[model samples]
Target chain A: MKKLVNNPVNVVEEMVEGYVRAHPDYIKQLQSNDRALVNARETKENKVGILIGGGSGHEPGFLGYVGEGMADGVAVGNIFASPSPDPILEVTKAIDKGAGVVYLYGNYAGDVMNFGMAAEMADLEEDIKVGMALATDDVASAPKEEKDKRRGIAGEFFIYKAAGAAADFGYDLEEVVRIAKKANQNTRSMGVGTSPCYLPQTGEPSFEIGDNEMEIGLGHHGEPGIEKGPLETADKIADRLVNDILADIEITKGEEVAVLVNGLGSTPKMDLYIVYRRVEQILSERGIKIYRSYVGDYITSLEMGGCSVTLMKLDKELTDTIDHPVNCPMFVQK
Target chain B: MKKLVNNPVNVVEEMVEGYVRAHPDYIKQLQSNDRALVNARETKENKVGILIGGGSGHEPGFLGYVGEGMADGVAVGNIFASPSPDPILEVTKAIDKGAGVVYLYGNYAGDVMNFGMAAEMADLEEDIKVGMALATDDVASAPKEEKDKRRGIAGEFFIYKAAGAAADFGYDLEEVVRIAKKANQNTRSMGVGTSPCYLPQTGEPSFEIGDNEMEIGLGHHGEPGIEKGPLETADKIADRLVNDILADIEITKGEEVAVLVNGLGSTPKMDLYIVYRRVEQILSERGIKIYRSYVGDYITSLEMGGCSVTLMKLDKELTDTIDHPVNCPMFVQK
Candidate 1:
């Protein structure tokens, strides 16, 4: 209930307005469909278009990622709600340069359906080639065999970066989609939720937990996780997350990886770095090499208290392009 | 009390350990004084050294701002307490290359005493010339006549940036100190606190407030504010902050300024953007041009729930040097 928002209903509209105005040099919202934020440096180049989005609560995620050398467009939605196909189509049409567009987003049902419909619309009505890829890297959401059923969390940032880099390298729509799939396949994430975030509209806690308890493996939107227990130390939590992620993927000794120790909204950066310290120790002990490190809030549930660890096993191409220059509002790698 | 830490008493020690290890490429802890984090890309150049530091709780503040084209060294301390003179002297000696060094930090009593003692020590022992600048940009802490009494808060980030750029451009220690002083004078900041943050060692809220109330003009460490009132809408709060800042400074029409809508840890970036939206509208109506914008968590007080707005009026020197390339772990510009 302590959200600092005006008119809970218009948070999305106001957020978009503020975002574009603040980062006016790199981003702008569509005049007709304000929810669709596109690159301010939009050019009719031959590169394939990269479009990414989801709900609005995850700031610096979809909107902040639309800039030079980053995702070209984003179709933002209401807090924790997927955008309809209208804005998706608008972004698709805006970013397309006859090289086709690829839709990438979390594996949520609403997003999948809406973005899929937008892809069909772009193909049938606009005559623009469209492809799709879903990020399914949250290992806690499903079993290894049912990986496609898993939800996307902070790992989606890596997937988007890989896809964007491929497109920036002049890859075709199909190749970009292929890279997105490969990045998704290589990425794994697990998060712990210490507390729930209250929604501005309802002014109610998304869920409840005991004062000293935390949910392990919870989804971004408070979906039930694997277990609930008294919160352990940062080292223990980092150990659990790293162990779960390693078990979900085939990454082994001597393999290099890109690491993301992401804040789940309210956790302190100190806490995330402490967790990263332990993660590095764990990885080093296992003979795994961490090629790059990111430790901060990338994607988040509104004011939710927790952290998530993501790792993307890097190949030759990914390692060379991992530092792909991006100047987005949220995730910038320069 | 919901901090994701291991040992409460060892929070600072672990934090430094984690920070250095996580960013080994850009930062490394001093072997002699582990609390001192120095730029990993150190060189024996003759340019004046830009050093920054303070208490530990403000992640990405003193520590994260050390890298190429940024500050050279940081004298880190425990949460909410200033560092001793030993680490200060250590950093001063490490970064100083014949050209001497400049010390810039928040205008806090403990910091002044400690850094002052270290400055004397460096002059007497190592014969390394040293100049100092204090960031006094928290307009809420004092009247214009007693500006030196104000705390640094988020506005100090701009001071550090200006000083670092001044040094990088091969300015002498005296000139760097002058630029830092000017940057501090031109900056102003105001923040609101919805809830208090708990210290890791104490495991208790630093201050208390009603669930439906917020303290406007509160300091970073839950210090007293100008007023306490019912939590108002984001727009109303933004208006109050902007009006107060404008009244404090004489920013005329057609002036250019940089804006920072910073989250105080737990406040969502969504709310910060909403606040920035209003901030932008007000500045536009006043005919002030926004030269650049930064919206996210920069200098945070652990997981305190609130946000702060900062403005730095730009002159020819500041405007040109504002985007000076920096690649620090926390703050980056390209």
Candidate 2:
């Protein structure tokens, strides 16, 4: 309720306007539909078009990832609400350079339905080749037997990075799709939410929890998680999240992996690193080699207090794809 | 307190441990003193050593900025408290190349006392040449006639970047000092806080406000600000912060400046951008061109809800130095 927003209904429009203006060198909203943000300075090269989209609360995701060597286009929606097919189709049409467009985003019902509809429309109506790569990497949302039913969380960053880099490397549409699938298959994430986020329209929290309690395995959109319990120490939290992710991902001894200790929203970077310290200790003791580690708020729920840990089991291809340079506003690499 | 820390007393040490381990390739603690985080992969070349430090809670601030083309060393203190002279001296000795070491940090009483003592000891005992550049860019903290009395806030980033880049370009200590001074002179910042951050040891917020109120010009350590009022619209807040900053700085028509709308920990990037929308519109209407802009949580108070706006009036020299490539975990520039 203490948020610095104008008419709550106009948060998306104003945020998009400010985002495009702030990063004028990196992104611009489409003239056809202001909801679709594309690379400001397109190279016009015939690389596979990487298009990402989703709800808007998770800043620096979906949109901030649109730039050189990353997503070429991003369709934005209302807070925690998926964009309609119209914006998705517009972004796909605009960024496609005859090399086809791949729709990338988290696995949510509204997003899947809307993006799927956009892909169908692009293929049938516009004669444009379109594909979908849904991220189902949050292991806590489902049992191992129902992996595909798991919701996407912070692991979307790695999936997007690898997929975007593959497209940047001029991989064909099918090859890009393959890389996305591989990234998603190898990535696993789990999160605990200590506090809930408010809906801008209602100015009320999405859910309620005791002040001293936290929800384990909560989804990004405040979805119900596996269990609720009293908040524990950083080490215990790290143990739980890392153990859950490792149980789902087949990272073995001497295997190289990329790790992401992501803050849900309001968790400080200091706590995330403290969590990462335990995660490193856990993995190192298991003889797993960390190729690279990212610790920050890569994805988030609005003002939610928690953290998520992501482990991406890596091979040479996955490593190289992720290592490829990206020049986005948030996830920049040289 | 709803925080993920093990022991309040050991928070700083553990956070430092996690930080060094997480970024082993970029930084490390000095062997003699764990509080001094130095560049892990030091270049033996005799470039001027750029050292920065302050209290702990501001993650990515005092330590996250240490890397290639940035601060070569950082001395960390406990949360919101200045480091003792021992770690400061250790960092100075470790990173000091033949060109000498420069001490850069915010202008606060405790920091001045500690870092000043360190500089004196380095000169009198160790014979290592040391200079100091204090950041005093918080416009709301002082009157125009006494700008030097203002507290440093997010503007510390620009000052650090310019000074570090100058040193990386092999500038002499005097020139680097000049650049740092110039960056500070040209930069101005203002912030509002909706909630207070808790001190780890105290296990309570530094200050308290009504749920519907906010403090304008709140200091990073939860110090008193200029005014307290009802939480206003994002646009209104943006107008107030921007107008105050512009009035203090002599930016005229056709002048170009870099803008930074930074979140104070818990505020979402969505609201920051919403604030930036009005900031950009106001400056544009006045014909002041934006050279470049950065909007995110570059510096933060742990779990504080608010945002800060920083404007750095740029010239050719300042622009080049600010744009210089930096390879740090948080502030990476290609």
Candidate 3:
């Protein structure tokens, strides 16, 4: 394995430690619970808190978004494993103000179970009202009718942005949840994987594919994608990803969207741009207007070689939210 | 090759087209010279235009740095190759506003020859004054006395930051060149490679290494590094890189620095963070302060597996310049 790490067992600890050390201006580890990385600056009183977290490995995903106007707190787990209820409760309590808190994360079985347990713990122990908006935007995971059951992909970036902006915009907890849910519902993502990421601890591949094959809907945790096929051109893959998303979202002519061509892990940013170019072409041909574009590794699966194309249908509010000023560690939007 | 691109010959063109479309607010493709991506918003009159460019493949390296308060324009080239004098001249003419323009790019023989030719062309044809600053921060490439012969690695991020900020801060082309040169001199970087990146066009590896072996101080373009050794732990490797940098530059106690732990391409950000943790430990132990930090893929070598650690020694002026607000498409500092 080409993974550069120390002991695999201590990967999360060192990662979180280094992350806090790297961006002390924006984030700090929770005093009691080391797993939680909260905003260094104090969250405004009576403003709803925006907490986003998930399993580790996908760096800058859950933790990179933590800042004053972005994710208020992050509860980090071990590699591809959810944080226990304890650290989640700690972050929830730390970020909570009189207005309560909202939890937004990718929709995965481990996350759903763990975050739900933490919400219950927070409610029972501290009387904190918590709202949740699980991002279920991966279109390749399930049929359109079963969108609710789909795993959240890179669309979590949009969900986190909207939720964070809404929270900072002084919206109440319920409204923040609504906005987060709306963003998740409107966003669609599909990923194609050319190579698998190895587990740092075990040095084991997440999944395997033939040297010249790729899987269209492979999940971040090496979960099954739609199908594995022979490697194709960037334009062809972009066409396939865009078609899959457009078919599920039903974006009308002249409507606007925020296009995010995200590299899974090892896919080069140059290729992502090439893919974004194709996505833009297909959208323009279909009369869909692109409001903004983000191309990079917003979320990744360790060293997995692949990419995902996500489109978040935008309205006036979502547009404003996307344009909202942000100072996150991973993403800085002015 | 796991590259997601069409005909390798057109990678640069498609990349430039896609880049301009993705960031119309910050950059636009030049009409007369498609290779140049200049500021979308009209540059302020009399402001020293800061133009940065080199080869493609390193996404967000030269092209990503273009914006109003950052790089004024960029001249893109094919993968791992320098832009011709024609496009460079066009960018110089377009960005020139009587105060002249300054060109800052990595120090490469091809780039030096091409950009030097462009400077002469601009002087003879357009009568526009041009200043130049070559980034030479790759400490592994040369000895201290031969620093001028060193290759510019990820340290270009800081060099561009200083030059762009200095130019936009109303400094003349000469002053911008001076500041950029100072940044380049003060910055030092070392990189390690575990796996080589395969060129999309040729589907050939940049270099080869045994599966259990790694190279220290490897150049991004596959130049030889220090030595081949058994794959070492992240901590041991970080120690070697930091030691080499510190030994070369006398950053004494209480002097602050801006640390950049960058991914070459395919190295996981999680691993970078782990590496950063070790780097921070070493710095803390030595009483060398880390003023600010950037931990991600700022400049990349396509899908090469490994990372580089860059440290830019900071003074008050460099500190302010580094923190100066930026709005580039690839980098945003607020």
Candidate 3 lDDT, B175-216, residue by residue in tens = 899899999989999999999988888899999899899999
Off by over 4 Å in 3: none
Q: On residues B21-84, what C-alpha lDDT tens digit does candidate 2 reach at each position?
A: 8778898888899999888888456888988999988987889999998989999999998999
Docking class of 1: high
Predicted candidate 2 versus true structure: per-residue lDDT over A1-334, tens digit per residue? 6898999999999999998888888998889999988998874668889999899999877788998888999999889989999999999989889899998888899999999999999999999998778899988788899888878888999988988889878899999999999999999998989888888899788778898998888888888989899999999999998888887777889999999999978888888888888999999999999998899989988888899999999999999986888888877876
| DockQ comparison, 1 vs 2, better candidate | 1
Query: What local lDDT does model 1 show for residue A31?
Result: 86
In model 2 chain B, the worst 10-residue window by lDDT is B39-48
- Backbone clash pairs for candidate 1 read none
Error of 3 at B40 (Å): 0.6
- Tell me which of candidates 2 and 3 scores higher on DockQ: 3
Superposition error at B126 for model 3 (Å): 1.4
lDDT of each structure? 0.89, 0.89, 0.91
For lDDT, candidate 2 versus 3, the one ahead is 3
Interface RMSD of 3: 0.8
What TM-score goes with each of the models? 0.99, 0.99, 0.99
lDDT of residue A333 for candidate 1: 73
User: Which residue window of length 10 is worst by lDDT in model 2 chain A?
Assistant: A40-49
Residue A48's C-alpha lDDT in candidate 1? 92
